[model samples]
Target chain A: MNGLDPGPLLFFVFGWFFALNIKGITDRTYRQASRFVPMIGGSVTLRIMGWIWIFVGGTLLALDFLG
Target chain B: MGAGWGGGGIGYSITLAETQTPDGKTQIGILTSKSVHSAGADFGLSATAGKFYSNADDIGQLEGKGLDKGGSAKFGLGLYGNHQTEVGTTNSKGEGVNVIEYGLGAGLGAEIGGGYSDAKSRWQTEIGSDKK
Candidate 1:
């Protein structure tokens, strides 16, 4: 009826997926990555921040697409 | 501090958050968190997005809430990266192993995250520990 772009919807969905599955992805990346890379990092912090990025980024992207 | 585990560091983050009303409406805004964590351990930080949502059949008044108040709290995933030059211990228990004294530090990695919600709150699931 109005104007709803599928592209923004896709981005929003992608951001949702990333935000939703950040735990698994962060765990795997840090655990295995630490071995070769060798470093000490905060796990929970990473998850929280990653979640923030995906959510914020996704929201703004969706707004941009629609507006 | 001889590399077993050092002191905790304070951290802060800002994220996007939204709220869902009984009428099925949502708005986006900032979510900030502050935390303290060990230099050699894990850290958790979160922000309370908003207050409870009340008053049905008041769409006009709801827009005023606008992330300032009302609705339920929201949660999100987090990831960070830090560049450091110190690793002065062999984390492994066994012998015949080599580590680093000044290698790549953590706190600068990125990942996607999600969470589960209960009756009044949303709980975020943490990742990246003992998965090796």
Candidate 2:
């Protein structure tokens, strides 16, 4: 709790939400968002993206704390 | 193009996209989207009614896919807005989607749009160039 930037924390939370795979939220986001590749399954793509966000957030948080 | 088991469909869209540069320089271009779904099959077409900001793009598309029971034709309207700011560009746009669905085994819809592009272009030009 070094009072570091909270941006990474916010990303972590959003990542968790996406990884949770709430059906309605996933569906609506899939319908509305502009995807880099539209042919992929929305659920699968979102899950992968969520994990990436989690990883990025965690790494940044760790860096903030260590630095 | 896309496919699904229980419900799925394929959709394609084309848009005349407007790209903006910092200090608000803008150019018109094109964007295309092709998608395939494997859940809840349906066929639909969407057209852009209006748009603003960096994305003042007009889009139109026709798509179909679905293997189900009874089929029906449907219509829908959607409004959307997007804004983006980066080092090189900052943009904002408001747009609408008009959809019409026509389903063979499932359901289908279609959309049509017009009359907004000209106004958007003029407005973008004025705001980007700081003209009155």
Candidate 3:
């Protein structure tokens, strides 16, 4: 019930999401010569996941602050 | 933390982790470079601790968890210190370089990590940059 407790949770979640998105992007680019269609799908999927993280993190922080 | 996508000299990493229970505790993370670059890998570790926002009434929280390429580039050992708070995060890192081949350098960085203060401080010295 302390004020700072949520900070770390938020950090961990964001870190996880950030790392995942980066990995997806790097992988798609690396395989560009072999597969072109899959790269598009991969990029879209990564973007969606990145947005999801932002939304979830923002919502949690807002709720925490509001209460 | 940030995610970037590009071509040529690009690097990426992903980690999925979970810990049972809930208690605000410090978590540490380590990163080291690989053979891709002759400058060698860069190693770093960081610690984080805070509370849970999900259950506002709940107390205690716990959690834990870069780049570029080539040319004359640079290489050395470094040390960093960082702190994170609701306001923001501040970090500084320092390292050393040898001018033409090696020397010394240091750097500091600060950013907001999920509303938590984050910072890193480091110092690095070029151990062996003239081996070529």
Off by over 4 Å in 1: A1-19, B1-132
Lowest lDDT block of 10, candidate 1 chain B: B65-74
Task: Write one digit per residue (lDDT tens) for candidate 1, span A1-67.
Answer: 1544333243344334334554476566456545654434344534543454456445645555655
Comparison by DockQ, 2 against 3, better one = 3
lDDT of 2 by residue, B94-115 (tens): 3332222222211123222211
lDDT ranking, high to low: 2, 1, 3
Candidate topping TM-score: 2
lDDT of 3 at B90: 17
Question: How do the predictions measure up, each by TM-score?
Answer: 0.27, 0.29, 0.22
Tens-digit lDDT track of model 3 for B69-89? 222111111222222121211
DockQ of each: 0.04, 0.02, 0.02
lDDT for position A26 in model 3: 27
Give model 2's docking category. Answer: incorrect
Q: Report lDDT (CA) for all predictions.
A: 0.31, 0.36, 0.26
Runs of candidate 2 exceeding 4 Å displacement: A1-3, A33-39, B1-132
- Give, for candidate 3 chain A, the lowest lDDT window spanning 10 residues: A33-42
